[model samples]
Target: MGRLKVRLILAFLSLILLPIGVTGSLLQLQSSELEEKERSYRDSMNELESTIKRELTQTSVSDLELNALVNQYAAEINIKDAEGETVFTSYKDPEAAPHNEAIVDSSTLFHVQAEDGRILFVELSSQLPFTDTILRSILISVGSGLIALILLIIGWTWYISRTILSPLKEIYAATEEVKEGNLDYPIQYRRKDEIGKFIRGFNTMRTHLKQSQEKEEQFKEDRKQLIANISHDLRTPLSSIKGYVEGLQDGVAQTDEMQEKYFRVIRQKTDQLDHLIEDLFQFSKLDLRQLPLDQQFVDSRVFFQSLLDDAVEDGKSKNVCIDVPRQIPSVTLSLDPVRITQVMNNLTENAVRYGADSIVISTRIDHDESNFTISVKDNGEGMEKEELTKIFSRFYRAEKSRSRESGGTGLGLAIVKSIIEQHGGSLWADSELNYGSTITFTLPFLKKELV
Candidate 1:
């Protein structure tokens, strides 16, 4: 911007000064030429005066001889006798002759006495070098220069206003719109100049602001849905617990075996409620970015082996089989062990809950060696494409009924995604309806010595 301002100022100064300088130079040259011509005219008049005086001293010439000698040097000549009567006059019209001494003084005048004692008065007037025509031409030239300068100034002003001031006005208007909660307004300028760059920056800022506003609105809506889901989930387990307690209060469990079954049912529902509450708490922490990570550079083989072992044991209880490859990569990884364990647990449990009979855990490193990926594949009743897109959204469930039989708080995958992202990784899913699903996540690889 500073450079642009300096350039405009310089250009404007050039526009104003160029014509003025040229015109001044021309006028100076014209004045010099006029002075030279006036000097030459004065020298010619002096020479004519000397010649006429020398000739009159030589001989008493006739009027015709005198007329011929002085005709070339003078415009009007009048010869007067000693009595002051005009003898020889060159004036075709007598009124055109000089009547007073003041008029005679304006022209070159000389008096020489002929041998016969008559005075020859010679008045020499030359045409002026600086004429009305030359003056008119000078006026026209200066006027044209002034007009062109004004037009140049006007053109420059219009260009500056269109390129600079116009965009500034648009930016001001966009700011006003943003202030009034309208983030969609964008400036339309395409010049690749300083002003163009500024406008582009402003437009980018507006786009980010609009996106941020949209995310905030979405977050609010997700929070509302979370509350409703929690209410519905809690009520189911709570109602069962309340009903069973009432059954015991009413002495409905008459036999020892029946009473034992009632106690087991109450304990199971209580556990479900406890699990739901714990999931809600962990999800809240992850959502709020308050979950602390105890990061360490740990061996990938040992980590996955331990994770698979736990998942295998847990899956057995749920009547699902967990499998792993024979060889797990021994690469080093930077991660929070506890968070990653939770992520694996969520994926495996989600597979089991969705009725997968077999779940396979696999790991591979990318060709670049910068990151490694882990995929939890399951032979479950996979989700539709539309559901897959939103699987990680909080409180979203592929099961529209949100049945308690699924035994989840609808935050498992969402929590998994958050934890993975916090670990400087990403999580996504691929699935086909009635086929199987693969939940893949990547973690950045770390050098063993960079711990």
Candidate 2:
């Protein structure tokens, strides 16, 4: 910034000095030429005076004739003899003359036999007025130089302010716009200077920040929608539980079997509410504070085997089949065992509620050793493509009221999504209507990938 100002100042000074320097050089040349002219004219006058002397001595001209000849010959000087008298002058009538005094020339004293015996008088008059004219010319040269210098500097200052400062003003205004939360403006510049670099950097930052802001806003909107859907789902089930329990308590459900069924429905509602509360707490921790996962190295193969065993024990009385791929890796992976178990249960439960009588638990360690991917593909009535679009939204239930009837809080996929993202992995759902839905999640390995 300071450098640009310095350059501008330098340009201004140069503009001011350029004309003055040229004017000074030309004035010096003119003065030298004036001196040469004076010397040439002075030399010609001396030669002419010598010829006049020779003619007067050789031809023996009369005084009147000589005076008339001298008068005719004189350019601006008067010629006279001894006693300091005007013998010949351009003006004969002394009273009606242009001058306030008479001419005084005493060069003829050289011809007289004086005591000193030498010419004491000079022939030429003093050129004080002509010298004054030369001095005036010099003054004019210096004055013009100053005027031109000032005019040029002023003109340059104006041009620079308009062309340079005007654009800079725009840059400043755009900068203020960014400060006020608008990072959508374009920076216009072509100069290969530091300001151009600044504009480019600013534009880069604006683009990045704009993207981040958009993501944040989208996430907020999704969260809001999720909360609304969850509340709606919970309200319907809660209302059903409330109505049935009240009926039983009021003896409206007179049969023992009817009372028992109403109590079971209340219990299911309580479990659903508890699960939703827990999901909400965990989601908050993962999304807002980025809490560290309580992780440990556990053999993933054995872990899935244990999950399969628990599923068998729980579903032995029900019509269900749980499957774990035998080719699952035996590698020790790091993760929060409890949270991962919760995720597995959530995915399995989602399948159990919406899947067919058969559910598959699959795991594979691909050539990409950077992460472990697990998929729980269900054979139940699958969802449409539109459901896949919002499968990870919190509290978004595809089956509507049926989701609450199936003990679903609609946050299983949403929580899985958050945890995967927190672990620097990814989760996604692929499904075909009435075919099946595959809920897949990845857990990143601690080390970077190897070729």
- Top candidate on TM-score is 1
Give the TM-score of each candidate.
Answer: 0.76, 0.59
The residue-by-residue lDDT of candidate 2 on 191-233, one tens digit each, is 6566667777877888888999988997788688657756776
lDDT score of model 2? 0.68
lDDT of each: 0.78, 0.68
lDDT of 1 by residue, 1-451 (tens): 5656766887679697877876676667667776786687677767766766777666665634555544454344555555767756653443433343222222666677776666766555433334643575577558767876787778888888887888899899999999999998989999777787888999999999999999999889988988888878889888999999999999999999999999999999999899899888987787688988999988888888887898899889888989887677777888999889888888888887787999999988774656789999999889888887899987778884644654587788888888888888888999998888999999988654322
Model 2 worst lDDT run, 10 consecutive residues:
106-115
Stretches of candidate 2 exceeding 4 Å from the true structure: 1-167, 172-183, 188-227, 290-292, 311-318, 366-369, 381-389, 446-451
Report RMSD for candidate 1.
5.9
